[model samples]
Target: MKSNKATIHDIAAKLNITASTVSRALNDNPRISDETKKKVLKVAKQINYQPNHIASALRSGKSRLIGVIVPTANRNFFSSVIRGIEDHANILNYKIIISQSYDEYAKEVLNTEALINARVDGIIASLGKMTENFDHFHKVLDKGIPLVLFDRTADVLDVSHVILDDHLGAYQAVDHLIKNGCRRIVHFTSAQRINIYRERKRGYEDALKANGLEVDPALILYSNMQLEDGRRLTEETLQNKVHFDGIFSSSDYAAMGALQVLKENGIAVPGQVKLVGFGNEPFTSFSDPTITTVDQRSISMGKITAEMFFEILNNKGAELISKKTIIKPELIIRDSSK
Candidate 1:
């Protein structure tokens, strides 16, 4: 069917008036007469006219769009963050375009370029695991685009960053275990290359020293912070006959693995070997014996990140300072750690 779509020229020709006059009348300009405004509105509604947002944005020099880059959407933590960003953007009448890097450095660079080419007003990003190079981020900064980093951030970059107090959280977890009659405690951690894992390991070591306990290098097992890696580490710990009465893993999945291994070896959690994990993932509460963990306040982190990005966009002043917002971690006591 031929649609009766109307344009400004069509309205002008039909009313025997100039297109500029029709445009002014439709826009309710004070210079236009009330009779002409009514005539234009009636014809526009009858012909089902609609203004093009792309054309409007071109004239206004603003896209009203933001970009978000994350490692992956599969994890609950990241998904929650995205939801918070989206909610805040909705309130401000801005749209978000998202890209996933799958923890690959090259993919992250590509995604960064894509967002920049799309001309988004600002960007929010979480660095991937294998992302060691941050030159791509500098490009965004050089383009005068506001960027905020969350969760896994690059320390070398001077920009807005939001993350949890990982070191303190780990320290508190280990201290709690020690106070609860755990003398020989082993730490299951991830690769120390990442800042978060390094902080967590340092916290564990600091807690041991504060309690006058000798930090056993042999008790520290580095894993990949995955479920399978955790399971493998647990098996190795059991086979090696590591003399430890408790376990503190850097990830909840790894802690869950240790719990499973302990059960298989007839070791009682809290009764024989206590356990604590990080992230407070949902599965932590549903294990055979619920796992104790530290809550990262991911949702709140997301909301705050979005707010920061919007603030930067609203006031891109010369004195605008970059911020590093650290959200505190909460200790959750469950059956795994008494």
Candidate 2:
């Protein structure tokens, strides 16, 4: 036969064996004799025969492929999670394709649609900010593909998820500052639409109430939570003569900005203005004064998220589908807050 591609039929033709027998032998079905299997393998090696995975998958109705979505590909938290997911997925002989939403609502929807069109066996994702509409996520469920969310997840979605306890993390952070003698604390957060930040803000408020401190409406500030915003807000608070002994920022980047401003203004961290930041990013450990923050256990969250997807995938028809996993956040004490 005039053919450029090598296939199992070519091996069978050379060995003068039935194609079905050759297939069984190639797969080590145990029905084939060892000697015959050895012979089949030898000829198969000579021809460099490769099994057609596409055809096999089509027959079994499984792509053995997973789709993953995150807010940003370059972020430390998302990258760490990707490593965990990759390690676990590789062991099961499955490949994953990843997409980033850059924390945009529209892009996340588009990415979800693209993954669905690609026909992945399952999906794992972290929701982006401003993603109130979840019809695209529903599309995945309608197609019967396994879906799991991690980190910034949707409360309304009834699928597998692995997430950090944001409320407790924030509560502990504020409580620690209070214990250290911070009375008037300022909170810097992102938009209220995002769930994690919202939860963290709530925790901040609850911690204040629990510590017998009145919730000051003027102290809770919302911004983009960027570096410049952090610095600007700190300066603005000072200019406005807002009396605050502590500041809890929702992001490390913002906290760093605030730290710089505090230093320039002769404010001593953990002495004059105790600062606590969320996200134990790498920079948090090496800053001028190490930052006290919440460790979300992102890598472990990733592994568990993938595990949840596989659990549902492996148990396709079973009713044990919708599962939720909450990863506890640990408080890391450092000079900034201690």
Candidate 3:
């Protein structure tokens, strides 16, 4: 059976010109005269001709496609980042391929391999929480592909990245609680080796010491920092009779869980126990007492991350110097802390 789909040769034959000329005209090459391009385009529309991107990519050695790997697309932060990347990519006549790692190391490795095999022009990713080894990302660099890491990044990989000042954000949150007379403030954090968590923990400790308070090991609770984890940890703290006047959680979901546990136990927020959370998730504003939180400026972070990726890509990986862009976090005080 013969396919009826029109090709450049069909348009060339109709215009009494060479197939190469039709191809150049379709691509808007300056070498092709405007009159010839007009004729080729008119016939192309009549025949419903569609350009094959794969064949064009093979000829140019450029796919005009970018690969994006995120831990999870369920979060607003990662989605916003992808939007920023897509918007900029569209302007450059490029398309994006997105993959999710779900914070799993093995999945992240598979995504990296898949993107590389797809022959993407570049890759943008955020390191997964369980990713200890960076050999997969290293492979990308070795293959001479542009790689950019945003948010959760690794120190071992010498790639460009954009992130928030997690330490400063934590410090401000803890310090704000201290200023409001929270003496025994409990800090909720994750035990992951990711730099963000470590920085937040450090900020919490530094804030306590700076306020003439001793760093009590009992006051620091480490967990996965999920909603259930926060609820369980808070319940255990109350049951164990741990005395605390405030709680600072590195995650908004965890903070909400703490709030729910406090309400269930008849504890009053701000009056008895002040509370603060990070990540300014949408629910923070909707929750009863409206949780106080640190805004990560996710939209700005996304745009900056995309811009950085393009900068490195335009440089064609010739300059491998590690560049870091740190965005400032904003503290949003609400009923929970007031």
Model 1 residue runs over 4 Å out of place are: 1-59
Clashing pairs in 1: none
Top candidate, metric lDDT: 3
TM-score, per-candidate, Cα-based: 0.84, 0.86, 0.91
lDDT of model 1 at residue 29?
90
In TM-score terms, which candidate is top? 3
The digit string of per-residue lDDT tens for model 3 on 1-338 reads 99998999999999899999999998899999999999999999999998876677778878899999998988877888888888888888889999999989999999999988878889999888899999999899998989988889888898889999999999999999999989999999985588888989999999999999999988999988889999999999999999999999999989999999999999999899999999998899999999999998887887788888888888883755879999999999999998
RMSD of 1: 4.4
Please write out the lDDT profile of model 2 over residues 117-207, one tens digit for every residue.
7778889999887688999999899888888988888778998788888999999999999999999999999878777898999999999
Mark the regions of model 3 whose C-alpha exceeds 4 Å error after superposition: 1-19, 33-54
Model 3 scores what on Cα lDDT? 0.91
Residue 92, candidate 3: Cα error in Å is 2.4
What is the C-alpha lDDT profile of model 1 across 1-338, one tens digit per residue?
97566678887888899988987886579999999999988887877777554554566656778889998887778888999999999998888898999988899999999988777888999988898888899999988889999988877999988988899999999999999989888888865767788889999999999999989999998877788877888888888877788899988888887787788879898799899999989998888788999998888988999999988888875668789999999999999888
| Range of the 10 consecutive residues with the lowest summed lDDT in candidate 2 | 51-60
TM-score of candidate 3 versus the correct structure, residues matched by position: 0.91
